[model samples]
Target: MREPVTELAGAGATTAEPLWRAATSARVRDLAWCTLAPPLLSAIPREFAALAEPGGAALASWPPGALAAWQRWLASADPDLLPPTIEELSALPGAVQALAPAARSLRLGRHAERLLHFALEHGEGIELVASNLPVRRHGPHGVQTLGELDFVWRDVARGGTGGAPQGQLVHWEMATKFYLLVEPEANVEAMAPDPCTRLQAFVGPNLVDRLGDKLSHILRRQLPLSRTTEAEALLGARVDRSEIYLLGWLFYRDGVMPAGLDALGLNPAHLRGWWSTLAQWAQRVEARSPGSPGSLDSPGSPGSLDSSGTSGTSGTSGTSGTSASASSVRWHRLPRARWLSPALVPEHETEPFETLHDALAARFAEPHRELAWRREAPVMVCEMEPAGASAPGWWRERSRGFVVPPGWEERARQRAVQPPRC
Candidate 1:
């Protein structure tokens, strides 16, 4: 039985202040990862962690901003069971068909990003992040916390629309992966560890990369422990680990993420930047922490067997032509948010939508409606050429744009191919 803390007559001890304890804990944790910008990142306040876990949502579809708002609300709620009263928390699963808009996830419009270096440097595997994930990285004779890691795959970059009304990382997507977000970690792209210290760690013996005459260049530049990301694109300058693992896998293969992401209800913008962010973090964290020998005991490989269920074409596979060419990819289902009328004349208040964008709007415009809501699935397809690819080089750089595919034409003519829920 535990005894209540009755003060001993001779003892002069007192309970430590949470603020003081947190500060010291943060300082030590900071020193564990970086020395240059030792104070930039702040500890994820435990208070934020206190948000209520609204059980799982039994949603057929989610409204646009609903998921992000819920996640943010959860992240801000009590970490304990108690919530901010029902008025402040509603756990009802929203209907997938119609979701209302909500605030975008932002640390002042900033979002979590992957440490590309850590991911790119680490060997390969899909990073599986469990919310309130318990990442135990063994450090010098002890262990350290992989702070407040969100559920984006360790190797893939993930995010939603970021369109005018960007969709949040949907609640359902987590449902598909068992709420597990996976990414790669072996070919670290961020966390710049000391050269001497890295040599000491027992990793990188079975690296698949070939050795080169510029062996030193590859060693310093392309080795498994190297960290990398493009600094130009990181908006809001905040570090996020959402896609760290995804970047790792992408470095190995891009198909790993795109084909399967929509099933999780993630928007595309964040997904696009996963790799670049991982690179940035791997370099930065390594420069800071040096991940001393055991600080980074590559979280055991998930082995080939465990990866069986993950079909190569899961996230963005069906959405693009290149992806379509690889395998018969079926997109993780998304609620049908179709264009009822042809993409509205581009408002006609400004310059035309190049000719392709304008023609696409013109050619694809026609009223669409679900047939009695019976099998109301949104029709999607990929178009390889747009007005014959404006200029030749654009196709290679940005090959295809996701517009109404030719397949929709059949549905428009038939009308009943898809029925609306209401």
Candidate 2:
């Protein structure tokens, strides 16, 4: 407790591995193997309780208001809980505002606006919805044709929509661009239901949360959005803490976070591995409609697969009790596949694809070599004879696909036969 230990070494003084380590070193520096400097592990959720000292406030050397905000957040478990309307929150005593710098959401909202602008300018017809974005925020309102753009804008956020907006946006196209939007902590029905549907319910009396500002910024931006509203609507429903962590980590690790990720928090475990994060975004990209890949788009009216998703999950549900009763969870295991930027697939990541080669590999190689799992879907290559016999049964005969024609190869060679410009 002497000199307010800023790190583990100063706090522990005597280096020894923790036996049943739970309590932290007055400063919450984690006890690692052999007293190594922190490995940049993530902060546990809302455990800022670790920051308090009995009667004193958080950040003992800093502002008391921050501790107050942190404590209030801790009590709610949902940082955005009892969200004082934009009016109420903005008008808080300067003491509270001084404590929680995150409450200054002007920058956060502005960033969102920038995102919408960036997305709308991506290609053609993409729309960046303002907090007051139109249900039909596209085409004639500003569009001309395929691959051609229409419009975009930015403004302060307002009720549900209003806050000090970092910015605002609207677009006409469905392809080419995306918005990384943020949401409040408590709303559930408005957000997309996730893979672990049962675990994320923000209601009932017991739930935990994350660093709100950081979570909202990362998830809304890094994860990609079919449309700004997809996320906007979902935010009104539930909070996806893991997605927030993963997205925040992605931007932070890449140095895109406004002040850098370490400036706030770091948690690789909650965010999952880089491989998985890449996989998640890659899957989202692949899931977009088959409209052109380089522009803001109007995909024959969104939801043509191209309309895309703002939240990570689809909006509808299988509510029939009969269907639910008949449903059985069938789990299947497959090899993990490397994530591909779905938009950049085929041309960007070439593979020697042919049921012939893959089937051959699967029959003789291990499961991973033959079968690949992209997202939750399985893709196994296989070759089968006309006689209804498959060399590698695990490799589905359906995968036996066409090979690149020699004519295309010759054309490629001809195209490569260019005169050097000196």
Candidate 3:
């Protein structure tokens, strides 16, 4: 959660504004924030704290002034300083077309990787040596792919100062993840007392991944890959350091802060969202509606609702006023590829809450190709409001959450207790 830098010199700004807020394009804003946002966890948990030290697996080496330059570039009004990729993206006629190149795949992780790749390729002070570099070895069966290196780069500004020598390479592993916290059931004693163990409470929406396991894999395996003999030969330069760029939102159950959160070493400024079963979400919305007994200002309410229970303005876009009632707030089901940023969508692309609910009901009630079993899958939904008079006919996301099917919580909890496959 670093403070936003003030507008660049000669830009005529006396106050600091968030970099994302300065960008005219939502996609570019997301890319800018992704490049500069702090890691989700402030530090490695105590269990793996030793790995963060020098000569350990997770040491980071950033070029001097690189972050500040990026921040300034993102916020600068000067067209000459803008990255070519961002400038071109900003000029696209439609949001979907602009995003299609980076979001070619549905995998959110891949989408994040593409965004970072674009930034590194076009931004200053860093030379991207290679990305998605595959490591392979001959096995008894045949050539086996060990793993892929996410990024290997050279810090153009390093070597002269106290930093590593000028030509040394740095390895970086990056991931964008979203997980919902599911507290353990009554059997608390069954789990270990280790602080890092609490990370299991954060599980992926599909229940196949956990934060603890992801961290363990990065520290034990991915970060060490660049130092291996095969990787060294392929790289032609010894990797002097390895780092991670882990970002994404963490959702809580109805916005409740669970206990022992300090043990997880979560970044205080990490992005957050709420989660609820479809029924629970509907109930909360109904309870917060105008004239309802439940107060709109109550703790753990779905999202920002004014005294009249209408949608509140989203600070990201500088839009103001209550343009829609609580019940009329538009919702768009976020496809996996579009989950990285606060969405900017055409008016026709969004639907009212009732329409969204009916669609979700149909989705859960019917069998589909993606679902192998009879169970239902959770869908991410974004609550959108008018983009104000500045961008009329466009809607922007004000808040987002996952609407899970019935019985999904119990299943997710069960998955949380099990060992992560990774």
Candidate 4:
């Protein structure tokens, strides 16, 4: 039960929100959240903990009081210290130049990278030295690329001389992942006995990525990249430390966490959500319909879905259980680029549950010519509620989850057991 490193601000908040959310631009809000959200895992799991040691692979450490600095900055009343205006951000670098609408097709990982790049360049106690620096070697045939360094920066707060950052140089590898837990067996008690083996059960929606494989790569390859002679020569400074910053949600089936997962070293406060096959989702929706018995709005339910579609015991954020009517609420399909922030949709843009279900069915049934890999891919859907008087004609995301096509779970189980192709 490791504590989260920072307090989170929900997306689509209007009033009494964090200062960063006050920005008028959607990109800015996403950037702020990406930079400040809690890491997916609190620390390297015990199985890989040895790789994080000083003589092995160095773990990332925040500069003294760095968290306090961010808290102060986020809470600052000074206009200059608040989140940068869109126009101001647009002028900073080419990485963010895509903040405009034209860059909507950018992958979520690249988008998060750009946002973190912005934070390191402008945020307190840090200085961005380089990003996406490639390491190459001249082979017998031609030049070959080994790998790229995600980020290298200086911790100015740790050691600075006359306001100039003269501190330990750090190499950081980051990833934004969304994995859904897969269970091959019907009986939970019959699951894998080994904790690391159990961790392999979390798989990406596309069935191409697994948590176990990713963790192994980060510990064995990515973190050690900075220590390579090729990387050191390119950086011009030996990396004093290396850290892995993993963020995003790990979704469970029907919003339920299996027992004995605490051994994985996952942060108890990590963002989470639920995943369901289309059939299961339809059943849940039918069960929660306005006239159904023991609906979601029923008194004294154990928990309700939050704006991010994660399960929460307290119904404070987004649409509360008692506030939103199941009949009137609509659903929105989240594009990959929009995954980072809680969605905000125009009232007219959303569709009824029936319409959404049909669309999903059509998508899953049809083979995509251009994207053959995505033919049966799971879709991320968000439940929406009216934004009230302050934001009339708009809707905000209340809860979100993944809806997979039939047989997707079996494929996911197969993929989970296979080694991740990093």
State which candidate has the highest lDDT: 4
Candidate 1: where is the Cα deviation over 4 Å? 1-184, 187-422
Best by TM-score: 4
Residue 310's lDDT within candidate 1 is 14
Per-residue lDDT of 347 in model 3: 74
lDDT tens readout by residue for model 2, 319-362: 12111111111111111121101111111122222323344334
Candidate order by decreasing TM-score: 4, 3, 2, 1
lDDT, model 4, position 261 = 70
Superpose all Cα atoms of candidate 1 onto the true structure and report the RMSD in Å to 1 decimal.
27.2
Query: Could you give the candidate ranking by lDDT, starting with the highest?
Result: 4, 3, 2, 1
What's the lDDT for all of these models? 0.20, 0.23, 0.65, 0.65
**Ten residues in sequence with the least summed lDDT for candidate 4:** 1-10
Off by over 4 Å in 4: 1-24, 51-105, 137-144, 160-165, 291-322, 367-375, 419-422
Candidate 3 steric clashes = 0
Better of 2 and 3 by lDDT: 3
Off by over 4 Å in 2: 1-44, 47-311, 314-341, 347-422
lDDT of 4: 0.65
TM-score of each prediction: 0.16, 0.17, 0.77, 0.79
- lDDT per residue (tens digit) for residues 1-422 in model 4: 01111122222333454333332245445665676555677767666755444554544555657655654544432333333433344446563554544333256786677667766776677888888888887779999888888899988766533443488778889888999989767755677665556777898888777787787788877888888888889877678778887887777786566666777777765666668888888887876747433322222211233333333432122223455677767888987767875666676778999999988888877765886445578999877777555556667666577988887888888876664333
